[model samples]
Target: MKARRQRLILEIIRQQVIETQEELAEALRAAGFPVTQATVSRDIRELGLVKVPGEGNIFRYAAPGETPPLRRDERLKRLLRSSVQFMDFSENLVVVKTLPGEAQGVASAIDQASWPEVIGTVAGDDTILVIVKPKKLVTTVLQRLNELARG
Candidate 1:
């Protein structure tokens, strides 16, 4: 029952914006789950749901690790353009330098972009190490990053 409720919650959020626990509980009840606010809150925490910027000033719940491609691309471009100070690559690794305290945010944007060639990233303070798969693809990834940074 818990699993099914959680699944429904995920489905509900994916279908429409859910901005508050009360809204989620109401939706659950409408779906026949009959959940309490506490239950909804617990389910939110257990599901690791995050609140993301919605239309204008509103924010709505979204599943962790789930980002629409267009939004992700725009976010990555904005972060790269504003924060990235330098970028270079060697072999299968691309090094990105950002303003102080910006590396993790930049790395997260890169990760969210979900580029096929990128294996992963490690960030520290003002630097990010982006690991690419296939040595030949490193330059391609670097070029893409440069383009994003330029935007």
Candidate 2:
């Protein structure tokens, strides 16, 4: 039921520059979902939806990837939470350690992150090799991954 609602809300936003919970609710209603503002609010949160600045101080409920960075952040958080056991960096590479059989999934997510520093990834049973650029950024990358592990 929740998935269906989420899909419909996503579709509604895809059709127009949705501006408010009320507008979204009305849209969903017209499309036959019979929803309320509160439900739409919850759906928005669950879907990781956010408002992006539109023309003249207005904001729109943008689906991820209609904008920059937001979707990557969402996917990275989800992936880090699920699969990364540990991560470290050396020179121009990051080594992500995962639970046995999980490295490939996490590696895939990191590749999808589209982080400018990340060049590519290679995965084994419990490890990922993240090729990075600008070797000077190694410590920064390590610290970031450690933070991800901690949280």
Model 2 accuracy (lDDT, Cα): 0.78
Poorest 10 consecutive residues by lDDT, candidate 1: 65-74
Q: After the best TM-score superposition of candidate 1, give how far the Cα of residue 1 lies from its true spot, in angstroms.
A: 30
Pairs with backbone N, CA or C atoms under 3 Å apart (clashes), candidate 2: none
Tens digit per residue, CA lDDT, model 2, 16-67:
7788999999988887889877898989998888888664457889877575
Q: Estimate each model's TM-score.
A: 0.58, 0.54
Residue 110 local lDDT, model 1: 92
Residue 13 local lDDT, model 2? 77
C-alpha root-mean-square deviation, each candidate: 6.3, 11.2
- Among the numbered candidates, top TM-score falls to 1
Give all candidates' CA lDDT scores: 0.91, 0.78
lDDT at position 104, candidate 1: 100
Q: What's the C-alpha lDDT at position 15 in model 2? A: 68
